[model samples]
Target: MSSLFKEVDYLRIPYADIKAATNNFDIVNMIGIYHSKNVNYYVYEGELFRSGKRINIIVERILGIQEVQLLEGVSVISRFKHNNIPTFVGFCYDKYLGGYLVSECEFMESLEQILNITPNPSIRKSEYRIRENLTCYHMLQICLGVARALSHIHDCHAIHGSFNSYKIFLDKDFEAKVVGLFENPEYFPLTRYTCYVDPESECLNIFLTPKSDVYSFGVVLIDVFCQQHAADQSWHYLEFPEIPEIEYTHFDDNIRKQMNSKARPFC
Candidate 1:
């Protein structure tokens, strides 16, 4: 009876309404950051309206597995409703445009900032371009949310396939949102980052199971733990010396690569 509370919470947002929020989809008002292949941005408003709403959009390749990701991934992630997970808007295609994914726009930097924000005097802290807080609680929430999300997908027999810290976007309130929801029965990359991936999953096959995602979560757990100790904790690692190295041999090889190359996210 008490367990039911976890599964019942969900947001009921219509796809068309999200479209309308973006001003019939205009590039001018799109608040997005540019990448090599695709573009991820938020829709604020355009010439179409006097005032507008902000939304999230992903412009990915029209071909290759990415196309499948947009179609199947959105359908998969969109199935489960969770606050930590970003709300999926839907997919759009037209003759002029290859494809576009519409969803809730979350405006926040990333956990990547932890390196600078949290100084690791042990690792010899260096100045960074940006500043942000990466509290221990924040790290815990990331794990909890990702775990819950994976559990939700596994219930449907769907695997995340691709998982990484970069793929996890942080919202304004510092909530973690894992990207790449669709399923790819065809192919999944073996290594996204040399250090973040699991050593075993690094073989040749794409991990199509919830346990695999859990393994990836472990890698994240390790990274955050390291950061917490080095910076937030007593600068002890500095004197302790000999901080063992970490190796994520199994992180997705293609999530970030294809996402930037063939995916060619045009901002």
Candidate 2:
């Protein structure tokens, strides 16, 4: 594993340090879990000490990741420095336990958790919840933040292959921080959130492109504006060859009532 990342300039965290930080993978520290390629990845909020300074971080324990894939992900993430993107600190690899990607945890919760959206009921429930209702202003801010992040990556000639609401994190101020990049296309079939996926890419079995990210972002836009799960609206578009038209009626009832007459047309 060391040889695989020899040329990469990233911290190679010791497995022991990761175990210590995450309290031996205790459930109390675990904050989130998501699946990829039929394997479960656990996200834990932990504190790590580096040069006598403690850093709050998110440690994602990824099971069933190949060494080459880990190396590629690390390489891609290390090049990113956008504010809307998580700061990749390093990685930990264990011969028996698999790989771990570490990043700075500046966010309060994932967008999915804050919005109370669940793609799969069988997945672990989120313990975090925000009492405040999502307003149009907040939704626009999140949309722009994510758009900037996507634009940054696209400018760098990279595609966020697994862009989705679950991959979006929100800080205390609701600033978006996008993660979960460099994902393998082979894992697409295993993902449960088909609504956010590009239908063309799925039908053609082609590699994901920047257009795919845009398609997913549109789905997220619908999710925020409608306060409805993307899956619920996906069935309506399955018969259409192009992206389905999102009508004014699709907006959340509260949002529609809140909108001024002039704003309705713009929206």
Candidate 3:
């Protein structure tokens, strides 16, 4: 009940088909900003000609000799099916188009937006508290949703690679979905602004491990718990100014153990 109502439906689309559907890559229908210059992808909002259903799709153009390489590599991503993962409708590879990865886009906004978008009030304002509507319960549900998604992804023998607040998306109901799976390591260093990156991975120079994901998830939990007050600081630098005593005592022992006074997040 905490998740979205939409069900994932996958479609295998040809290069020509997508070209026609998007009217030779019309820029007007594009939905959101590109994730990053380094990520090499864009999300376009387009209508399927056959069904006329509006779709938010992730498109990646494979460059040069990498076209053939990407076509082979993306086959697995196209088949990914999980509640927390974005649905892969289809993809296309052609001499003109290179290669593209299209997925069902469910993002409303990043968790980072939720934490950072609203300006911090100089004085405690009731409107800010009342308007920003997420409660502790909602926060817990978000954490559970992410954990379930991560567990399912790991069960499929893949690590999210980039797990953090910026990579998490929320639906209208505030249900969380993870993005940035099958990440390119080249963009890893650029994500150092967030403290969710695994210290072990940074120290060892290894890539993609379940342990790293868990560590990142722990950092995300801390961020979620801090709510709108979450500054873009590293986990070690986080400051929780206030803790509701009654609500804090209400959380179970397991949750309490993980969120002790020092704010050490453990998987």
Best by TM-score: 2
- Candidate 1 has what TM-score? 0.53
After superposition, which runs of candidate 2 have C-alpha atoms over 4 Å from their true positions? 1-4, 119-131, 183-193, 232-249, 261-267
Provide the overall lDDT of each model, using Cα atoms, as 2-decimal numbers. Answer: 0.46, 0.71, 0.53
State how far residue 95 of model 1 sits from its true place (Å).
Answer: 9.3
TM-score of each: 0.53, 0.80, 0.58
Q: 1 or 3, which is superior by lDDT? A: 3
lDDT of 1 by residue, 178-248 (tens): 55544643444542323334445655445545666777677666555454221122222243323234543
Error of 2 at 18 (Å): 1.7
What lDDT tens digits, residue by residue, belong to model 2 across residues 1-267?
A: 666478564578888888999899887776666664335677777888876889988887888766667777777777888999878888877656988888887644667766666644433344444524566677788899999999988887777776777778777787888877454344323232355768787666677777888998988887777776666443533443344444444777767765767566433
Expressed as tens digits, the lDDT of each residue in 126-217 for candidate 3 is 22323246655567778898999888767766666656776676666778877653533332232322345565665555664777789788
Off by over 4 Å in 1: 1-66, 93-99, 114-132, 184-195, 204-207, 228-267
TM-score, ranked from best to worst: 2, 3, 1
Checking candidate 3 for backbone clashes, the offending pairs are: none
